[model samples]
Target: MKTQKNFRPFVAAIAAALLGGALAGCAPLLVGGAAVGTALMVTDRRTSGAQIDDEAIELRSASRLREAFGDRAHINVNSYNRQVLLTGEVPSEAAKQQAEQIVGRVDNVRGIVNELAVMAPTTLPQRSGDTLITGKVRASFVDASDLQANAFRVVTERGSVYLMGRVSQREADRATSIARQIAGVQRVVRIFEVVDATDLRQLAPVSTGTPATVAPAPAPAPAAAPAGGAVVTPVR
Candidate 1:
């Protein structure tokens, strides 16, 4: 019986050692994978559509809370899997309730977790700056015909602008380009919604610059010229 008990202890030690070694080997792979994922998330102008949607929900929630509570509320919105978690501070019970109401209004919002502390109201200057940043980015979308601004949610932290939107590859590129061109943009993080090429092709390119005279869209029929008249097919 003693020998058998001793054998069990030896077996347990071997098992533990194997498990430790296995975990050690997996550590580097796990780290590498995480690094790659993070890099892709940060660098790729085109990001997964689902992630963009989540970010949109979060941003809209925070923005609505900001509007309803005005300078009274300081809110942070975080989303995961369509669920929004609202955390921050407000000055009163009414303000906290108002924040909840605002979050509820955002579309695609699954659930909310309000963790707001009642405190002093936010300053006028801070609120004004937030409004300015939001208005500028929002107006840019409204003016740009080719871009879908509504698909995105804009969030401003300090001087930085965070854009969240679902988009085609082309739309992602255009959006990033526009954000970069904006004068005060500190950093643009693309929480883009990517779609297939077929869907992307359907999006029309906006005409803003000099007008070009070109042939009309082709009709799906054979064209014939009158007798002695030549039919001209433009050369590429």
Candidate 2:
């Protein structure tokens, strides 16, 4: 009976280890599914058409990028409301420039932020670490009560977190603060198209016979395109 009991504990330990390994392997897929489902439920600031356009931009840009650079570059194309943020590494500066040009030709791309470095591609382990950092930053946003976590898109490359969203100044500041607090985030770069509180309020559906409010002042002009085809527009 004692021998059987010892064997049972060993079996239990093996079972626990197998279960842990299974959960670890499935974590990314499960998280991705949850993210997509949550995104569908949220009231995003972008119009439905804009959302579709952003998806299309990512697909088309990626296709073109593959055709141009193939294995020479490791590029990530992320589009939030038609603004594309390109990260990863290329073999040369020429490949980097070509990436931007290819993405620029995609339909409905309002702007591009090419943060691609000219170096050897990052290994899988580095990419895995970036994914974990991104998850931490995203969880921080979800924990903050005042912020609409769904409004921001988090992308991490080599520890730099690129935040893309259509958000107000206050929300942008709050997100930046949260991202900076995360342990692995080396930098937080804002790629937000900043709107005012009034704009955000207007996003809500109006009821019938609601009194009209005064029109808000026009938004400031977007910042000029930065050199090398990366558009980093500051909120004025």
Q: What overall lDDT goes with each candidate model?
A: 0.47, 0.63
The residue-by-residue lDDT of candidate 2 on 98-183, one tens digit each, is 88888888987767777889998888898777766776666667668999876777777888777776677778767877777777
Candidate 1, residue 140: CA error in Å?
0.9
lDDT of 1 by residue, 1-236 (tens): 99998676445534433332321111100110111145444432333453466556755665566556555556767553344444445778887787777777787664554545577644557544644554566656655799865455554444444444335666665665565555555555443335555654554222122211112214312122221111111111
Error of 1 at 190 (Å): 1.6
Instruction: Quote the lDDT for 66 in model 2.
Output: 78
RMSD to the hidden true structure, all candidates: 23.7, 11.9
C-alpha-based local distance difference test score of model 1: 0.47
- Largest lDDT belongs to which candidate? 2
Which candidate comes out best when scored by TM-score?
2
- What are the TM-scores, per candidate, against the unseen true structure? 0.38, 0.71
Model 2 residue 46 distance off true place after TM-score fit, in angstroms: 0.5
Candidate 1 lands at a TM-score of 0.38
